[model samples]
Target: MSTQEERSGRYLDFYRDNIERISENSSPYINSFRQNAIEEFKKLGIPTRKNESYRYTNLDTFFGHPYSSYFMPSEPDFVKAEEFRCDVTDLDAHGVVLINGFYPTITGKLRELPGGIWIGSLSEASRKFSGMIEQHYGRYVNGNSDGLVHLNTALASDGVFLWIPEGVSLGKPIQIVNLVNSDQDIFNQHRNLIIAEKNSDITLIICDHTLSPQKFLTNAVTEIHVGENAHFNIIRVQNEHNNAAKITHTFIHQERNSVATSNNITLHGGLVRNSTHHYLGGVGAECNSFGLYLSDKFQHVDNYVNVDHAFPSCKSNQLFKGVLDDMATGAFNGRIYVHPDAQGTMAYQKNSSILLTDDAKMDTKPQLEIYADDVKCSHGATVGQLDENALFYLRSRGIDKRQARLMLMFGFAHEVLQNINVEALRERMDNLVMQRLKGELSRCASCMVKCV
Candidate 1:
């Protein structure tokens, strides 16, 4: 039998060589950070199925395109983003636009931010505060050892930087709209950072608005730091073209007595992957995570979440719901780890999926490892089809067959969606989900006899 090193493919070797070549080119903008990061990236390289965290996700096949094959469209070519507006009335929110991988200076109107809030480009922030720029740039991200993270950090010449000062609370959500305008086969990597100081409160929304005709790759990373007694909420809505690829990595670090919540909505995409890692670094920290994904056709969506209890008395709760139809595939993995010193920790996790087609694939796993004897922890997962009795009950009410099925499907998914807590955003998601479920219900109703 050949040794492990003998199986190291040429693809890995090419990646390493390219890293060295690019770093040595001496581009002032990227050369300094690139050399050190590239070396670490080579040491880490790409993760294989052997990695427990990615066992269910096949990154090799998912990221088959050459690293240099990503196309860069100059400006807004096919992305007609004017179609998406902040339509909610009486809502005052700041908006920033990113077209393809570059941010548009003249594309979106700019206004003064509320006092005590800093929102702008990372480069701009780097210039204004070099100390902060240096301390947090690569602190939360381990991109050097991860391919997608490495690629994002290496190419993050432009992205967002948001800071909320202490004791300030923004009543309205900050909307950051991402629009992709490029030819087919282009790849985009976006990195964003958010820092909330002690006792500050804020809300943020990330809307993916792109209609690209090509296979677009959006490898994005968002790092959030919640200071002591801070409160924050983040909602991400992804509605991209059918040929687009999406990967999101979000990390939240909480201080003592801090509170953080994140809700992820996968309305539509070709291949979407979402990862959330929360560190309960201080005592009394609380974290909440909820996710919903609706998959159809050849669409593929993967979600992985991990919560770490590094201190005593931390509380965490997680819930995820998935709906898969046609030949689509979806997966969910939620894990919680309690350290030995986290004796008084409290954690709960649950994941459920409703499969509307036998051809559909769904994977659900909930894991827990408690090193503390006094901790309270539990995790569970479920994957099954729609309830026949519920469908019959709805149909018996004289509702249309398609409508009846849609109600049954929505009932299973609404648990997570309703928890959104924001009426406006919740209504928008409700409408999109209505359309998706109705479409699936129509297809399922047509094959109702055969499906049984």
Candidate 2:
């Protein structure tokens, strides 16, 4: 057999041998889903270059290396986390920390918010909210869709779960910090769920970071449900080490008159792929999606977004931007699908990228499929280098060449950052973008390795 076949066989063997251990902590209902997911994975296998959705990305090379299958839960090292914390930590928010995909029990009382908001472990909540969890746990995610998603569903044992009852608005945001610390190569899977009832509101900040230089893989899935007339805001930041890879999927379902927004910011990683899906299930729902990625060296970043307008009078807007240097690679695919019965739909998408070096690469696809007659939809994409005239103008104004170049690059990336309405979060992103432009983020002593 070939190297690819050999790698596949090894993964199959490991899954078959660890079936029992992987489901040791799972409930019977979830275990059944896991079994079905494993079977699905066996049929689909891993994605190859031949796959249309994965044609630009090559996964076979990464599978050649062996990685640990499991990570045991342990007490988190807060002292170690201080070095990686960002500016958002100072905001007024409830903090939830996870170490290597396991929730850490820290000292303090859980913040009691107005209305009824419960934040805790999904595994612990399974006992009391089993029925509620069962009604929506596997409702949004399809089990047989992708091999990576199936693998995550098969092995995920614990993650965060949040619930907001009707008519309640959270006084502050909820910050989730996932810190990875490992001495050797490892794999981690996390499953998260967020549910908001009618007329409720919430804000969430998810931060993913690596504490060590070890090679690792993270597969995570998050399912969110927004009830009628609710509002939800979420910001995701991925700043892992250069030796790590991450594949994450986010699924959102919006009810009638609901509003939702998601901002995905990728600063550093060796290979990162993010997939976000939004379903507008009711009339007059709206969604706003934004993304920004800065890469250098041999780093690779891919982003895929799919928005489905199933009902009439729905709106969606997507904007994504990227800056690549050296030999970095980046891809953006945005798709908008309007159902035949969905009349009066409005959708817009735009993707723009800047290649700082000749060796840099970028691929973008903005697609719109509209079946309705009275809908307005448009899409566009652009990939090019900085304007030499603009760069020269800054240089002539008594600015150094390096600083001028940085200013031009930041000007290209600031449009996406401006979509963030939160003052604290937007400021944090601005500072990080400036540091990245100046080549200082990875060079700091407390931070991890450089993307290059």
Candidate 3:
């Protein structure tokens, strides 16, 4: 067998060997779902390059190294969860911390959630609201088609759970921090569920980081449900050490007149793959996707987005931009699908990149499929180096070549960064991206690794 197949076989064997223990640690009501997912994973195996959706990404290569499951909470390695807090602690947002895919031991100190909202560990939420969790846990995802998602469902132990009752508006954003730290090669799985009832509104910030230099993989899956007339916004930042790999899938389902927005910023990682899907289940639903990736070294970043306008009068807009230097590589695939019943659908997708070095590379694909004749849809992609004229103009005006190039590249990426509604967050990201371009950023200094 080939090396990829061998790695797949090893993962399958590991799952089979640890099935009982994994199930024992999970809630009984979800045990059957977990079993079914594992069986599905066994059938699908790990996705290979041959798979059209995974053409630009190869999970098998990332999984070639042996990685044990996350250590139990009682382990000594998990006792330092408090030291791994995100740098945004001073912000007004409420903080929810997770270490090794589970709630941190210092969770008690978190501010009490406001009325009409429930935020805590997923396991506790499952026990308290089993019916709701059961109805929506795996509703939007297809395990048979994606082995990575199936594996996450089967092995995931805990993550953040949030619920907003009808008509409630959270004035402050909620921050969810995920930290991966271990002494050996380790893999962590996180599953999160967020629900917003009718007329409710919420803003969320998600940050993922690595605390150790050891080889590690973090696979996270999140499902969000937005009720009628609700508004939901999410900002996700992935910054990890070079020895860390990250895979994340986010699914957002919207009801009538609801609006959803997702902003993904990829700052650093050895290998990172992010997939976000939005389903407009009701008329007049809207979704906006914005992303920016800054890469260098041997880093690889892939971003995939699919927006489904299953109902009429729905709309979606996607914009992704990247700046790559050295031998780094990146890919952006954004697809918009409008159904036949979507008579007034409006969809647009755009992907652009700037290569800072001759060795840097990027692949961009933006597509639109509309079954409705009256729909207005458009898609476009562009990849090029910094404009020579703009750089020369800045240099002649007094700026050095380095600063001139940095100015042009930052201008190219600022289009997407401008979409951030949170002022403080936008400022923070601006500094990080600038530092990254100047090669003055370190994983620890960038808030990916905890130094204290």
Candidate 4:
């Protein structure tokens, strides 16, 4: 067998050897689909450059490492959890921490807020809220052909679960911090579910960080359901060391008259692939997706987005921007699909990037597939360097070359950053982006490990 095949076989063997243990730790509701998921993973195997969706990235390099999988819940480090603070300063929000993809026990299994809001562990919710879990658990991504998604479904044990009751609005946003800290190379998988009932409003923030220097690979999946007339928003920040590889899949379904927004900011990682699928299943549904990525050195970041308008009178928008320096590489593939019966659809997609060096590369594809005659859709992409005249304008104004370049890059990134509705979070991200452009630490100031 080739080296890639050997690496793939190791996971298959590991799953087979520990199937019993894996099933024993998980609830039957979650275990019911493991067999089928594993079978699908076997048929698809690890994704390679040959896969059309994965053509721009090479997964073999990240999977080739021998890493220990976390199938069972480990003991929670209460001391660490108590002392750890989020990088975003003074943000008044409910905080949830997941260490090595397992929800820490110190925070309790589940928390119920005053407004009928539920936040806690996914495993506990699976058992306690089996009816709700069964109704929406695998609905969005069950038929997906991605092997990595299936592998995560088969191996995932615990993650965050959030529920907002009907007609209620959360007083504060909920922040979920995922930390990977281990002595040895580790592979972790976590599954999250969020439900916003009818007429409810909520906001969520997700932060991914690596606290140890060992090689880490994390495969995370999140499923979100927005009820009719509900509002939901999410912001994700990814910051990890060059030794970490992070893959995330987000599936969102919107009901009639619902509104949902998703923003992703990627700062540092060895390899990062983010796949987002938005399904507008009801009339008057709206979704806005935005992303910004800054990569340098050999870091790689790929973003794939698919938006489906299945009903009439729905609106969708996508704007993704990236800045690549040194030999960094990036990719953005965005698709907007409008159903035949979906008339009066307004969809727009745009991808723009700036390459700072000759070795820095970017591949962007913005596509729109419309079957409806009365719909308006547009897609475009741009990949180039900064404007020389603009840089010279700053130079003529007595600004140094380094500061002028940083100003241009930050201006390019600010378009996406300004879309953030949370003022405090936006300001914090602004500072973080400047630090990253200045070649400072790519990690959060509060984090223990200093990985550039």
On TM-score, the candidate that comes out on top is: 4
Report every candidate's CA lDDT.
0.72, 0.80, 0.83, 0.89
- lDDT tens digits by residue: candidate 4, 330-374: 999998999999999999999999999999999887767899999
Off by over 4 Å in 1: 1-33, 66-92, 107-112, 142-145, 440-452
Candidate 3's residue-wise lDDT over 274-361, tens digit each?
9999999999999999999999988899999989999999989999999998999998888888888998999988888988889999
Which residue ranges in model 2 land beyond 4 Å of their true spot? 1-5, 76-89, 106-114, 443-452
lDDT score of residue 50 within candidate 4? 88
Model 3: colliding residue pairs: none
**TM-score versus the correct structure, for each prediction:** 0.86, 0.93, 0.95, 0.97
lDDT rank, highest first? 4, 3, 2, 1
Supply the global lDDT for candidate 1. 0.72
Residue pair clashes in candidate 1: 184-214
Against the true structure, candidate 3 reaches a TM-score of 0.95
In candidate 2, list every pair of residues with a backbone clash.
none
lDDT per residue for candidate 1 within 194-271, as digits (tens), equals 888899999888877564455677788888888999998888887765567788888898999999998998877777
Per-residue CA lDDT of model 2 for 134-176, tens digit only, reads 8778677863267777877877877777888888887777888
The TM-score, computed over Cα atoms with residue i paired to residue i, of candidate 4 is 0.97
Q: What is the lDDT of residue 56 in candidate 1?
A: 67
